[model samples]
Target: MEKVQVSPSRTGSHDQSHNAKWGIAAGFSASLVGIGLARFAYTPLLPAIIDAGWFDASKAAYLGAANLAGYLLGALTGRVMAQRSSTAFTLRAMMLLASVAFFACAFPVSYLWFFVWRLLSGISGGALMVLAAPAVLAYVPPSKRGLSGGIIFMGVGVGIAASGTLVPLLLQQGLKQTWLGLGIISLVFTAIAWKGWPKQDAAPVHAVQHPRQSNNTTLKALYAEYALNAAGWVPHMIFLVAFIAHGLGQGLEVGAQYWVLFGIGATLGPLLAGVLADRVGFGLALRLSFILEGVCVCIPALGLGTPWLMASSVVVGAFVTGTVPLVLGRVQELLVHHPAQQNAAWRTATVGFALFQAVAAYGFSYLFSYSGGNYALLFLLGTGAIALALLIDIVASRSVDEAAPR
Candidate 1:
């Protein structure tokens, strides 16, 4: 079927129509595949490649950090420049950059060069992450916005699952060839997405107006919120695999297997959260996911080996990382009247979060070294941060409700 525009007049009817709902879901899912595979697949694959004796594990960790740093920079750039860029164009450009960057990783290069490729990939991946949901939201009607947002994020899970399945299968084909094949896959999908991208609508009229520069209190608070949450999550986010590799003293192959399990769990968490959000509300979904995140991180400490570890991995994957889009959804809801302002605000929040995450990555890596590569403490830290984030969300949601027009 050809792409159907969500006309202003037909917004209500189209929202209820099965075709519109599915189209939004399909588009979001496809974009997620592009974004997630390009950005996230590396975590699982790195260990496999390292175990194959292709590179040092420390270099892989640094490369991951470099990519995240690029992501922070890209989010800042996008928030400023992308407001005027067409959604279709932004999505296509990001995917193309990601595809080429990942493909670049396949050629043997020095550690410094590898970091450069990862950094470029990071920026491309970050741009995709920031743009994908907004593009998805533009196509969805306001009435269905929450549900659509949930479905769009479910794409993250699918991407995670794909990485899990793809890495192990490719490892059988040899490490270098596997990366080359993955790059080819990225390139092919980018082409397909470019061809199928929905046409951009006139920009949505959304922006919250602040009084002519009152102390920037609200903006400052939002930045603080993003920084706090990002700080809490960054340690595990950057070094989870490294923690696993060092803690268990497992070979790269063993680490890859666990990473695959983590991906599988991550995939399921979002879908379940989406369903719950549709039934309850966005705030409740986030809280539940956060609670599960704490449990998931702590459960692996029980020393149950592969099955228990896998179960914990899935639970961890499901809750911890998946709540990000829901957080963005809250930002959208907060600025329903000011689309541009809201977009800028969200971009700002993301940049703040990404920067904190980058800083945390380096700190946590050194901390892990100091602890003699103990991974348990990292999980402990993750659990505490997740608990705090959940509490903050609850408090923030209550404030939003109180402040909104009755």
Candidate 2:
């Protein structure tokens, strides 16, 4: 079969092109605000929050897990919301609520209040991810989806990079000021992006249906692989800074700087992943991502030099976060004829991702305590999980190949 490329002329509409551009920008900012300010900021602030007598070590870790749990809930709830409302409404609402959560934490609240705010912020990140990126892609031309997804997914890295750098610097001003600063930054952006969501004036909200197991084996394989990938990321996302700062005896400043390196990988990851997936097919790209991520996680575990650890950060960041949109892109391929099923698959994938992260967060925190803050061991375990996911992909592939001959 010969493939016909989709050109700009084939894409149709000067207005839709403009809208798609803005839609991507909105997703980028939404990602920046939702994940960068709301989620990643917590990492740089975690040590400070504990040092200030706000919470003990155990509670601090639990807080991280709680935020992840909220994100899981957001995914489940976002699915329900998608059936009832436009993506624009869901995206805007989540972003606004996330900003409010950030702002509320600026007050000298009780522990419960802080937890509530963190959870709300996490909820915003997950819901925005489910709604915002898909909305933008829906407006894009078919040929451009991969690159566009890569562009939009850069938000995770942007957020991570910004928080990794900004939060540590802000901590010099004290925790209260840091919280206020994060809140203000997120709120301002959400305000600007308030009405910017592109209106898909053509499609009705009810066009998409609930997910079906039309391809049960493929769905199961994707879910297992994705869930494992989610767990693989939690160690770094929640504890990498702490490991570098406290475990390595480098202090928070140095940790924050290296985190910026990790963010750099994250920033570059999706763009490469998307383009590569488009060229080579998503299955191979996914395998490559999982393999590299496994290697990246092991660099620090090797007790190598500082530069090696830093290099690993970038690699891990890129592969871990970058792999997301590629997987979603793969889901798009699997359901090319079933557009509604494709959308439902994306939502379900997010839920699976979040559910694993929430569980991994608490478990990793406990492992951190149980092993006496053995950061190296935790990273090693993450490496093993990545390997397992890779193996699952391999098994699924072989099974599919064997079935084809029958």
Candidate 3:
């Protein structure tokens, strides 16, 4: 089906000067497979992988880090790849790679095999993040960028929700089937989105004649804040269910239920953030998201009952998942003149976030070891990182008005 822009025509019909809606859907499906299924789905699958006797706990953790390491490499590599290839090609290729990776995981292979597939999946996902959004938003009017981008970003949350909701049921069947199921889902979405991308005939979607010096201070600050978000968001995505079920004396079933709520919040977040960004500026929307996420990060520590814990789950889910598109909107606006830099900047932000989260995931173990199971300290550390991100955004806002043109 052809996606139409929301504008009316001068001839008493719709005027789609651009296929704005299709672009958004293309970006959305790319993101859904990339971050949503490729990255976030790992957390939900961890237990199943362990139960399937693929790796010990230590090796499993290491394998998880391998995925992040690949994400870092992919982010850097994707920037260069985007300059050389069409978004339609790269997007379709990555989807195929991701589908292959998930299909490979279904086998009871050696640890190295699993590692390689996981790494490939991460690379595919990271590249899409770098390439897909800009392709979709390139033709969208500035006024619609936020909501359109948000819709695309909502794919991540949708993927998350699918993993949280579907994985558990898949686990009941077996790990092999779960892996196959995920691969099929990726393929289905990829097929649906394949035609949504517009063909590029003039220049590559991310072409650059020369490397130019970047002068956008707000862009840099946004990148830094984007990095910091990894500290707060990843832990909850990976560990919130554990802390809720075990740390708070709830059972694994209870934790699983809460995770679904988190996924639900994530699923809805991008749309909400998109609307919010449209109403308020991207900067304000981003700042508020970070602030609210900080509060949510600390919410688990108050020993709140199920009600409060559930609320925290939703808010944390929404904010953590929501911030990506919101930040991407700002990145787009800043580099609107230099479309090539938009891909580079997005890749740079992902690299920072990927590397930080990879290191933080490992580092949190030491904090966990030293505290003798005081998971609260780990949560505190996460809160501190978010607080610092919030501070940076606030300080940057005061010193440099984001309203200035690059």
Candidate 4:
């Protein structure tokens, strides 16, 4: 055979590409199992728990909130844990913890026990959201990061869709069986992703020792935008189904169908948004997303009709999942060379998101009750929050430009 030697550069490139693929796969799995299955799977299960007499409706609602609280705590602490341990270790540990939590939930020994497990699962999801993409993206070329990030976040959508579709089928086998089924699925994903993380630990945190003041201002703006965006998402996430089912007199089946549409939109959103971001830039893509989502969010409030309602459900669902990667991508753009800082900043963003999401959940819940189940009010408020987020980003962009040395 003729001697054919591969050049070192080509071999290295091939290795890098291979590693990036596996790393992205791992990230996808992490998000799917941690956030998708761990957090969202609980939503569909909530009514089941109430119906099964496992817990009263009030207790079930409180139990659901426990996960949100744990998510906030996890976001606050994930970066610290990653710093102390390796990113790979922490990421793997969180995935494992999430799987374990799902299995434990199957037992439902008591409300306290279920709550603790649910809380732990939310913590796993929070940590994964903060850590997984950065870990994987470190291996991806900068040019391809937008699409790769979309792929990673697409897991959330997949999880959402699965919860809507699969959970019902799993419910057929019984509630405990459904929990076990989710746990098994999670465990399978964990095993597949076990060795997919990058072999080396993440780079140390010395990239940007002295970030500029403008960067600080921009970051604060991003945080506020993200927080408010979370608030904006609350109405659709919490009330869309009920609004359709009872508020519109559409009935439960029709409401669930809308939710399925939301899930489908969510599943496709990240990819579409990522591609748009890649072509138009994250900043512009993000602004466009907000505008589109804001409009869609208000459609229901306008009482347009079924087609418009469907559009609202789908677009809002898409933006809810799509905005994640756009924000994360924007963070990377802001801190291009600082991997550690990127992780830390993303952690802060996730914390803000979780915090505001919880607040909005409660606030909107109260408004819904106080307003006598006025779903349109909640949707309009959500739109206002999104519009405010857009305004903040616009102002922040101009300020950053003005502060730049021309």
Assess every candidate by TM-score: 0.81, 0.92, 0.85, 0.88
Model 1 weakest lDDT span, ten residues long: 211-220
**Model 3, runs deviating above 4 Å:** 1-20, 201-211, 214-216, 245-252, 332-343, 365-374, 401-406
TM-score of 1: 0.81
lDDT of each candidate versus the true structure: 0.64, 0.81, 0.77, 0.83
The residue pairs found clashing in candidate 4 are: none
Error of 1 at 389 (Å): 2.4
On lDDT, the leading prediction is: 4
Better of 2 and 4 by TM-score: 2
The parts of candidate 1 lying over 4 Å away from their true place are 1-34, 79-85, 205-228, 231-246, 249-254, 301-308, 336-340, 391-406
Count of backbone collisions within predicted model 2:
0
The TM-score, computed over Cα atoms with residue i paired to residue i, of candidate 3 is: 0.85
- Rank the candidate models, highest TM-score first: 2, 4, 3, 1
Task: Itemize residue pairs with steric clashes in candidate 3.
Answer: 28-152
Question: Which segments of candidate 2 are over 4 A away from where they belong?
Answer: 1-12, 82-85, 200-212
Model 2, residue 93: displacement in angstroms? 1.9
**Residues 128-216, candidate 3, lDDT per residue (tens digit)?**
87778777776676667666777887888888888888888887788889889999999998997888776872345445645784787
Predicted structure 1: lDDT: 0.64
